[model samples]
Target: MRALTAAAIGLAAALALVLAMTAVGAPSGETSPEPLLTTVPKHP
Candidate 1:
């Protein structure tokens, strides 16, 4: 019984976090999905 209650609480918290983020519209000017860097310098 104790384990079940703990699991339910954790699930609720996670759902709340997701909803909050969606409501906030992500962080302002934040890099969406981050950027990938893989460029080589050109030789002169």
Candidate 2:
């Protein structure tokens, strides 16, 4: 039971770290270039 609790806590901590890094590393909308998909021509 203790091991299970520790594993769950570790998983939660890792998830939090990943989320924090993504939030910090992501580019702001104003400075970001347009997505490539938008520039591609659509075939009808």
Best by lDDT: 1
lDDT of 1 by residue, 1-44 (tens): 99999999999999999999899885667566966867876889
Clashing pairs in 1: none
What's the residue-level lDDT of 27 in candidate 2?
A: 69
Q: In candidate 1, where is summed lDDT lowest over 10 consecutive residues? A: 26-35
lDDT of 2: 0.87
For model 1, the local distance difference test gives 0.89
TM-score of every candidate: 0.61, 0.56
The global C-alpha lDDT for each of the candidates, from Candidate 1 onward, is 0.89, 0.87
Model 1, 35: alpha-carbon shift in Å?
Answer: 7.9
Q: What is the lDDT of residue 37 in candidate 2?
A: 67
Number of colliding residue pairs in model 2: 0
Candidate of highest TM-score: 1
